[model samples]
Target: MKPLSIITLDQISDALDSIDLLGEMRSAFIAYSSGRSVIPPVGELIIDEQPPGEVHIKYGYVRGGAHYVVKIASGFPRNQELGLPPGNGMMILFDVSNGSISSILLDEGQLTDVRTAAAGALASSVLGVPGARVGIIGTGVQARLQAVHHASALDRDDLMVWGRNLGKCSLLASDLEAHGLKVEIAESAEELAERCRTIVTCTASHTPLLTRPMIQPGTHVTAVGSDTPDKQELDPRILGSADLVVVDSLSQGLVRGEVARSIDAGTITPGRVVELGQILDGSNPGRSDPNHCTVADLTGVAVQDLFIAEAVARSLV
Candidate 1:
């Protein structure tokens, strides 16, 4: 039996610098939507204690791939108060041929964050206008990642951000400015929506923050905050009004995220949605008209974890 290798966060972070994360994420989505990967529904546990939190268990395998992956990640917003990062988790890799434990990646949620950011960037690049100023809603880790990723994707360094906490928004702006991005603090989400053609919402809000009336035509919105049924960032009507609606996983999107909310509200039909992979693979059109309103409801897919983990494991070897 081969020894199981355990990797740490530092090593994974270093390895990521050499990995083409955006390319890997793109391939992951294509594989998933093309029926080349075997991924089950996500399992989740919501903690309702004083500091609310949620844990997601995602696992899956790609056909004929070298390894399978099982990822466990958690998000506890109040952890920052205790001087700890809110995101934490690990990934377990197994030999595909023998079903034997191969490696354990103790990334502590960095992989999840990066893969998600990559997905958001890729979606925006495919569905959004080129060189459009980006707007981010949220002041947490994802907000920063999405800002930076979108900057790199669109080759634009100017961004507008809005959050409930002005202090946090200012802090995020400072961090992004250090990355060479021109940051503006929007007084409200409505203001942010009006200014930027490409907007990425990364909050954990249970209620809608971006309403239909706030969104303008020819805008592309990426909603990554709503991974659970009860969580929502965009009003259901936003999806109903969007000219193009995309999702990472159609099945998952139909049950969670903004798409689900719109469906439940009788605003949009499930058939109106298209998978992001379809756009990547040229099976579906993405924002053909500059005047079209587009929305991408990303719930996070397991194939992303599988591809990213496999890339990290191969890089380590």
Candidate 2:
């Protein structure tokens, strides 16, 4: 036993700097879509706010050639009541040769947060119009990651933020401005949606935060909030109108996604759905034109967990 190496979030960031983590993530996803990999089912246990249910766990494995990653994430909102962070997680990488544990990365949810944003950025880079002003719904952890990740990907400098809390949005706007980028806090989601063609949502809302009327032609929206069956962040109409709809994992989304519910309701269909991996591998079209409306429904994936694990393992300690 190597005593289960512990890699912290700060160390993970340093590791990312020394390698092309984003490129690795992109390649992993593309390989997944190309049918060269297998991602097992994600098991989730939800905690209702009413009773504040038990802590939930989601674990999975992604096998890509001689490498494999085992990922586990646990969330307990009630941990906040106990004065602790609500979410915590770690990943274990296996060499696949002799069944030896290669590395254990304690990402502290940073891998999930960052990889989710990076995937969104990759989707935006492939689907969004160049130099598009970005719109963000919710100014939480995921929102901050999205802002930085997408900015890095698309060379976007203008950001528009909208949250239910004006003060928080204003704070986020000021923070981005301090980074030498232009930021605006919108009064409403509709206002933000109307201004920017590229929208990313990362709120913990169960209801729809964005509506069809708010969207404009050529807009690219990535819904990263709905990882469970009961969680939703965008209007069903948005899915109905999107010219190109891509998902991180079709099986995961169809079982636990807002878009999946719409597909089940006949508002959207499986035929209209595309996988990001397919698009990345050139097996499917990404963006046909600059004016096409695109939507990437991200429920997260096991492959991403593996991707981040590889990134952390190769990082200099």
Candidate 3:
């Protein structure tokens, strides 16, 4: 029997630096949408205690892949108050040939954060305008990753950011500036949306932050929050008014995310939603008109976890 390999957070982060994270994420989405991967629906546990938290169980396997992965990640909004990080979790990797546990990736949710940010960047590159200034909503860890990943992917340094708390927004802007991005702190979500053509929302808000009136023509919105049925970031009407609406997974989108909320509100129909994989695979025309307002609601799929875990594991080897 082969000994199990235990990987730490630092090792995982270092491995990711050398990996083509965006390309891996792009492939994950394509495989999932093309029916080349087996990803079960996400299992979630919502904590209603003070300073609420949520735990997500996401796992999957790619057809003909050497390993299967099960990832457990969590988010607690007020963890900073307790002098701890907001996100934490790990991934378990198993060998497919012998059904043996091959490795334990103690990433503590860093993999999830990076993979999600990579997905956001992928969405921006495919749907957004070239050289457009990016707007980021929310000042959480995901917000910082989204800004950094989008900057790297789009090859743009200018960013506008908005958050409910001004102090956190300032901190995030300073942190982004250290990464060589010229960051602008917006006074409000509306102000941020008004200034940038490409917007990424990575908040934990249960209410709508970007409304229909705030979005301009030729704008592309990539929303990575609202992974649960109750969490929402965009006004459903904004999706209804979008010329193109894309999701990471049609099955996940119809049950959660902005698409589900919009459908519940009778603003958008499921038939109108296109999978990002379809666009990547060239089966669907995405953003036929540059002036079209596009929105991508990503609820975070398990295949993403599988791909990132596999990539990190391979890099370590």
Candidate 2 per-residue lDDT over residues 1-317, each given as its tens digit: 34346677788878877766569779868877876666767766556676364332344444435457776676665676787765677777776656677677887666777788888888888778888899989877788878888887878788889998787688888887887778888888988888998999988788899888888998999888788887788888888988898998888878877778677667798878999988888889788888888898888887787777776776654
Q: Which parts of model 2 are misplaced by more than 4 Å? A: 1-4, 48-64, 78-83
lDDT of 2: 0.78
Candidates ranked by TM-score: 1, 3, 2
Stretches of candidate 1 exceeding 4 Å from the true structure: none
Q: Per-residue lDDT for 130 in model 3? A: 80
Q: Candidate 1's residue-wise lDDT over 1-317, tens digit each?
A: 58899999999999999998889999999999899889899999889998999999999898988888899999998899999999999999999899899999999999999999999999999999887889999999999999999999888888999999999999999999998999999999999999999999999999999998999988999999899998999999999989999999999998999999999999899999999999999999778899899999999999999999989988999
- Could you tell me the lDDT of residue 14 within candidate 3? 89
Q: For candidate 3, write residues 1-317 as lDDT tens digits.
A: 58899999889878988999889988999999999888888999989998899999988888898888899999987998999999999999998788899999999899999999999999999999888899999898999999999999999989999999999999999999998899989989989888999999999889999999999999999999899998899999999999999999999999999999999999999999999999998998898887899999999999999889989888988
The count of residue-pair clashes in candidate 3 stands at 0
**Candidate 2: Cα lDDT at 245:** 89
Q: Using Cα atoms with residue i matched to residue i, what is each candidate's TM-score against the true structure? A: 0.98, 0.91, 0.98
CA lDDT, every model vs. true structure: 0.93, 0.78, 0.93
